[model samples]
Target: MRRGFKTEAKTLALELRAEIGLDAYSPFDPYAFAAEYGIAVVQLSDLDGPARHHFLKADGSALSGALIPNGTGVVILENDAQPLTRRRTTMCHELAHVVLEHEFGVSLSDERKCGLSGDQEAEADWLSGEVLIPSDGAFRLARANATDEQAADAYDVSLAIARWRMNHSGARKVMQRARAKWA
Candidate 1:
């Protein structure tokens, strides 16, 4: 991700969290967040075959999710066959696109048919990570020497995501510094 874009995403994540009344350590509810912003969340299963196929890779691995522009609002389509954790991440990602007001196109050749530029995808991915596992929450867990499992449990995220966030969000560094101070 570009440094400037990541900074913007982080700022947006914090602002969204505050707008939704989320505390530093609380698990973010992407559905509620979408609802607050007047976006609709729909399951891929609810769509017809053609529409479903549009969001799936030929290998059958889900595309995770997609954001479709509606009449003034947007609809988020999530692959429900995946695990809940995956669905949560996908929803957050799609919602990130909406929150950032990324453009969409009418043609399939468009990136995921959503006109998301490469930079937009990176920003959304980073922002979604922040939304699912806020830095403050990661730090709180790290301060307690929490394991990846603990971070997953605390944030209701997948273990892999927890590990990434704990390692990459500067939480581990903060924890080490706190430990040094105590020592």
Candidate 2:
């Protein structure tokens, strides 16, 4: 990711949240956001045969979601068989790619073009995380002494994702530092 990319992503995520009549602390709805952007979100259950089995019921499926671009607009294919939290994260990730307008070649059937590799993929991942749980929201949860499960429930995200954001997002560390300073 670029140096200022995270900062930009945070701003954009907040703005997007506000656009959907939500605050930074509120849970993000990727489906609604996709609708707002005029992007079609289709579930993998909509597919039949091999495609459905590959993404939904396959063992160790590397694919979580995909963004398919067409001549007029793009559509997001979400693996609905995954858990609710996972489905949300995947939707946000696919939407992030569309929002970033990253260029890509034709997508392969396998895991070859699973969101286009390298920087674009990284950017989409980071932006998706931010959209799912803003850093500011993480900090607030930390300050409130919220546990990973609490954060997950509050944000409608997975506990793993909540823990990752609380730890990796520097929210807990910042809260600890603040407590030390006040103490």
Candidate 3:
């Protein structure tokens, strides 16, 4: 994570949520967001041939998702074979690329690779985290002393994502300080 990327992501997340008319604690509907943004979300299985192989792999090194440029809009291809939560994360990541208006390379592989530049990937990942689990939502859960399981349920996200958000979003520290003060 860069020095100010997290802050930028947080701001962007909040603005996007507001633009989409979502509450701070509501589960973000990536599909709805994509629809509003004029992006199409397609499943990997729905594709044929090489495109399918590019996203779904027999090995675990499969791509989670990719954002492809259309004529004027964007198309998001997700590996739907994965769990729903994973798919959601992938969608958000691709959506982050769209929202950030990242320039596409000439080849699909350039934009599709799992290993993008560190800063780009980090920014997208951080923004996707904020999109899925807003800072305010994390803070609310943390203040309630919510477990990772609780956060996952509340946010409709994977346990790993919930854990990361709770720990890294400044929520856990705030909650801990509040608890200490009360004690």
Candidate 4:
């Protein structure tokens, strides 16, 4: 990702936070936020191929605003059938896609084994992490030397997400140091 574009994406996220009453370090429920913004929430067990793989999509190729077709103004989220936290993260990822207007055809990475490849996906994941587990919460938990499960419980997020947040927020070194000291 280009530095300019990355900054732009962060700016967009900040703008969205202000627009939707989310602060710099406040946790926001993606599902409820979507509902407030008129984004539709869908949970179907078995969807078709494209629907299942895409996770979410707009009416056509335009990925700037809500995914609602016509005048519905609804954002659609495909459930992964995981826990509520996972579902919320997925929805937040989709919302990031919309806000970022990620390029539809560009490939972020060139790994055949990896399914979701793109700079867009990475950005979306970062955005979702910021939204769900804000910096303050993550920093507090990290400073407390919280376990993975404890952090997850505190943040109301999944273990995987908690770990990722820790890693992304530059807590990996802190965690390593704590583990070594305890060991």
Cα TM-score per model: 0.84, 0.88, 0.87, 0.63
Instruction: Give the lowest summed-lDDT range of ten residues in model 1.
Output: 105-114
Regions of candidate 3 where Cα sits further than 4 Å from its true position = 58-61, 105-113
Q: So what's the TM-score on candidate 3?
A: 0.87
User: How do the residues 1-183 of candidate 4 rate in per-residue lDDT, one tens digit apiece?
Assistant: 455654465556656766777765555567666766766766544557675545443542212112334343434535445557756666677666656665332211111111244565677767767766666566677777778888778767778888887777666676678778999
**Lowest-sum lDDT 10-residue window in model 3:** 104-113
- Following a full C-alpha superposition, what root-mean-square deviation does model 1 have from the true structure? 3.7
By lDDT, the candidates rank as 3, 2, 1, 4
Error of 2 at 68 (Å): 0.7
Off by over 4 Å in 4: 4-27, 45-74, 103-116, 172-183
Question: Residue 109 of candidate 1: its Cα lDDT?
Answer: 22
Off by over 4 Å in 2: 50-62, 104-115
Which residue pairs in model 3 clash with each other?
A: none
What's model 1's TM-score?
0.84
Say which candidate scores most in lDDT: 3
